[model samples]
Target: MRNLKTVYLFELSSLLKKKAYIVTTVIICVLILVVTTLPTLQSIMGGENTGEEGAFQEGTFGIYNESDEITLTHLGEKLPGVTLLPYESEEALKEAVLEEEVSSGYILKSSTDYVSVVNNVAMYSGGDYLMDSALRLVNEDLALQEGGHDVEAIRSIMSGITITQEEPIVLGKDVQNNYWVVYILIMLTFMMIMFYGNNVATYVAREKSDRTMEILITSSDSNSLIIGKVLASGTAGIIQALFMGVTLFAGYRLNYRNYDEEILDFLNMNVDPMLLLVYFIFAFTGYFLFLFVYASIGALMTKVEDVPSATTLVTMFVMAAYFIAMFSLGLSNESIILKIASYFPFTSFMVMFVRYAITSVSLFTVAISYGILILTAVFTAFASVKIYRFGTLNYGNTGSVVKLIKTALKDDNGR
Candidate 1:
């Protein structure tokens, strides 16, 4: 035990002494700080006031008139942000949407129930929302005019269905401010972990390919060496995350100073500091598990050229897990796939943290998921250590995956 401790400390000290590590850390910290501050700076420079009227820019819409009563002249005057271009046929409007002459335009069919809006672009661009809202307004106005309903009567009916959406008082403020910061923080944490976790694996691979691992392993056991390196990399990643978080917080304060009370109330309710700490712990543990396995694969490679191919399997797994977590946000925790992913070592860290942050997750579930993660991490660490014990001493061309596994298992049995 003492020998293991000695080895761990020695490896950590050696890493600390390396100038490259310090330089890389500084570079990453600077990058994170810059990236975090840019958005706030842009917001300040741009100011709160927008020159554009409404959410979207004014665009020409091609209105295909099938009925003689509905003319573009009256419709164009009624709509505020749209310029109506009269098209004789639906084909012409469809061609316009396809040809990029128009962002999006609608075809008013003979049937009153349906108005088809051509949306080639993704929904995020705000074009889809604008088109849908405009079409609905036009339909309502046409209906009232056709029915010969009095303007006052139409207004009364429209005003009768009052939608009172009482914004939930969160942290003494409204829901909008409450939810945004928490969501951003959660996403940032996940990204940082993934970024640095890959770095740790790559670092190990580079050392192995350069024949530095053998020299380092001579003075340190694999377990001690891997733990020290993983810890150092994890610490660096956490520092980057914290720097960005602080920068963002500062930016929010400076930029939104006038709205301080509302912001504070929103943050106070949604941003749980304890949740961040738990997420970090889980992120580090799950990341280390994958890093260890990745390093083990790296050990089987003979050159830096081999590192990419060797690590591709792990990369795919990580990417899939990342996408799944992102897609599963706001979904029920009891969802079969999500529940299974929450307990799966590869995905548990990101998915479970997201699930916990967005919804009310039980402490028992958190504990159980983390417990499984810890056990898996320990097992991976031990297995990788045994593999490194043999693989570092190997010479010549890289061994086959089967041979590497066989040798690693054999080394474990011999130990």
Candidate 2:
């Protein structure tokens, strides 16, 4: 027991002292700091206030129309920011537009023709939202005139169409907020699995390739050694994750003091704190399930170089689950694959949380999903331990997963 504790401490301390660990931590901290300072930096750079200074925009449009029915006053109401100046002659309007005295011109070339709008820019560009709205209104007015409806009748008909909502719709905000949570959850899943899961695999493989397992077995039981190291790696990862979380929280508060929204509070629109906690716990379980499986696979490998090839399938499987969760979102919450994925342990880490976040499910359904994941994780962990014990004893290259498992089960050394 004492030797296992010593081994656990040595493994964790050795990893913590590595250059990769230290540098990665520092880079993450720096990124958090940069994110914290972005708003302040933007404010310092003197950004544009589009709404307040809207009137400062140039370009007065000249109009050539001999209509007594339409006036600049009617057009001004439809087009908020445009300045329309009337010219009696088409030639005068054209010359004004060319001289840049007026930026553009709208001419009724003939009574039979539609209004022509032109700008002097070298390449034709879609101007702005206001311009598009103005053009649509002008076309509608012209069409109504052709239909023998006056401006007053058109206004009456348009104003008669009203929107009535019994309950205010917030479905968009709910989905958007859910997406924000899902994105953060996916990042957490990737980090945990890539760092701690791969760490367990590589650690086991390194010992095997180094022939250090012979010495390790002499001091402690295989179960104790594997469990202790798994615990140590998990503890180390949890500590680093907590530290990063705290640092980010502090940076967020210090950086965005003036900002009203916080990540936690921002997502409070649809999900409750308890539900989020459940999501986090279930995700951790799924990670643990895979981490131990990775360790067992590592035990089978005779060389460190074999880890990537052996574990590539598992990595791809996890990645596929991530993509499913990513695409599912609010748009496909009711999908058959997503529904199946939510109950399965390998994918529940992301799919379940995402589905729960964007859609509503009963408490009974959550309980069943949680039960299945817990059972799978517990079973896979124990089964992996037996395989780990046998795998460490077998030497040379492991050809296939089936052959390795067959040999492990046949070996009398396995638990």
Candidate 3:
């Protein structure tokens, strides 16, 4: 334990002082700040993208809606970018438009089951966007009528359901861009695994290539040294992630303070603090878990140049799991591959992280995945320790998998 602490502290301090690691950390922090604060900067610069730039002049249209108990006046109140001029009679509505009292006229031809939008010009660009929304609202109203729901019940339901999901069963309306946020988080998690995990292999390969492993192994067992280095490298990654996360949160807060409704209509930085905590924990564990594979690969290679090719399998697994998580995260009936990933330790980090984040996955299921992941990590680290001698003392390619397996077969007799 004392030896491990010495090695761990050495590795941590070495990585923190390395030019590559420091540069990468600085770059990531800059990226987080830019992504989080861009909307606020745009608003300040009068370049915010609210999609309301070319919107029609407000309060300019005449409305004649006589489909149900819902009056034209009520519907007009809902339309944000345009004004609806209500009339006692359709004649008055049409006459006002023709006489230039209003910009144009709308006569909703509705039925017990259908809603259509008609216009005077026969050419309405923005009208489609608005009418599509109104049509969805009308359809939802018709759906609730079958259940014989009262006004209060209907209003309660209306408060949540929008045009997109007739029923968002897994996530609520309050979760704006839930899929997007979680997907980005998954990618970020994989990025950390790739960047820092690759560094583990690189560190091992560097030590071997420089013949530093010889002196180090003389002082300490290879397993303890490798484990110590991995622990330290993972600690550095956690520190980097925490810094990036704090920068994102701080930028979000600053943006919110200067939030302009017209500019920030598309900006909602309201990430659930609970979700952020989950993301950080998953990223920390997942990156550390991936480091074992990388360290093993590093121990296999004789040269630092061989690190990337040696760790190709790790990259492939992470990419596959991320894409699968993208496809299956919020689906009502998740894909079979995702279920498989949830059980497999290699893929569970991403698949299970997304499941718990966006879906209705229970805490118990994620806990089980965590158990499998930790066990796999331990097993991999032990196996890496066993094979550490195979390539570290050797001087060339070592043919990785085949040679490592052959060497493992002979460790008892050969030594």
Candidate 4:
């Protein structure tokens, strides 16, 4: 335990000394600030021309009323962007539509219960849908009046069907923004871990290529070295994420202060503090597990250039799982692939957390998933130690998968 602590601390210090860590952290913080401030900036620039031509032009429609006693004043008030013109007869209305003096028009025949809309132009244009909506409303009112339904009762029923959807609870509070915030946060977490996790793998590969691994291995056991490197790199990634998160929160608070009440009401930002604590615990654990895999792959590489190609398989898996998790949000039928991915070691960290954040996931499921993830992490770390012990000393082209497995097995036997 003492030896592991020494190695972990040494690795952590080494990462802090790297120029890449500092540059990457700063870049991420700036990006978070920019993104958080954009909404406020847009609100300030409100009412600018949308650059769409002919979007707000008034639509002209001819009307022929066979019932001279019935007033059409109510319909005229409802059509804000439409101009309704009077016609002497149905033929006159159709001629006006055909001549393009009006886009379209409606004829109300006294003998028939239904009204016919004369559409000479294509219906794809803006005026068609609006005219259709207006006609439907008029028909509905006519039907209700004919059925002897009270106007007040009809209005009451229409208004009573209003929907009020409640957010799913996470810990003791409701999750914010229809779970989109949680989805985005989880994705960002996965991306950061993958990015810096690869950095750790490349660092290990660089050490092997430069022959520094031999000297380092002399003082530390394989397990100690692997644990140390994973801790250091994982710490770097966590620091970057923390910096970005803080910056983003600060920027959001500053820019959205005026609209805080409305935004909070809309997003339902009532997160339980304990939920955040659990989130951090799981996030860190998941991060270390991924880092172990990354470092193990790095240990197998012969050169820094080979790192990208060697880890392509793992990267693809991570990206596929990420996109799947994103698409699974709000779907009634949860995906079987996503459910399996949530338990699988490498993908579970991102997938399960998102599920937990967005929906009413059972506590038992979270516990079981974390248990599986931790076990997998331990197993991967143990395997990585063996692989690092063998591969660190080897200087050649990248080893085959079978050869690396055999070498690691042999190293484990010796140990």
- Most lDDT-accurate candidate: 2
Off by over 4 Å in 4: 1-7, 43-76, 79-178, 219-221, 260-262, 272-278, 333-335, 355-361, 397-399, 412-414
Residue range 1-415, candidate 3, lDDT tens digits: 3488889998899989989878988998889888878767878897754454455434466667776756554455456667666666788876786687976666666632323223354565566566556556655565678778775676776788866647455443233446678878887787878887888899898888899899998898676788898898888987887888798788877777556564365555566676666566665666777887788778778778888987887889888888888777657455668778876888887787666655566668777877888888777777766667655566665555656646754676224
Top candidate when judged by TM-score against the true structure: 2
Worst 10 residues of 2 by lDDT: 48-57
lDDT of 2 by residue, 1-415 (tens): 4467777788789878989888888888888878876766756775423343243344577878776555667667776566778888988887887777776677644333335455445453433444556656866777877888887776888899998879557553366656776778777887788778888999899998998988888888787778777877887787778878888778877766434344336724565675687678888888778888789889999888888888887887688778888888747347889899999888887788777777777777888988999999888878787888987778885478657877776678885
- Candidate 1, poorest ten consecutive residues by summed lDDT: 170-179
Return the TM-score for each candidate structure: 0.67, 0.75, 0.67, 0.68
Better of 1 and 3 by TM-score: 1
TM-score: model 2 vs. ground truth = 0.75
- Residue-pair clashes per prediction, in order, are 0, 0, 1, 0
Every candidate's CA RMSD: 6.2, 6.4, 9.7, 7.5
Q: Which candidate, 1 or 2, would have the higher lDDT against the true structure? A: 2
Off by over 4 Å in 1: 1-53, 57-77, 80-149, 167-198, 208-210, 217-223, 257-269, 272-278, 355-361, 412-414
Over 234-328, each residue of candidate 4 has an lDDT whose tens digit, in order, gives 87777777788789779877877544455657555555554555466666777787788789878888888988878877787678767877777
Winner of 1 and 4 under lDDT: 4
Q: Which ten residues in a row have the lowest lDDT in candidate 3?
A: 111-120
lDDT to native, each model: 0.66, 0.75, 0.72, 0.72
Model 4 clash pairs are: none
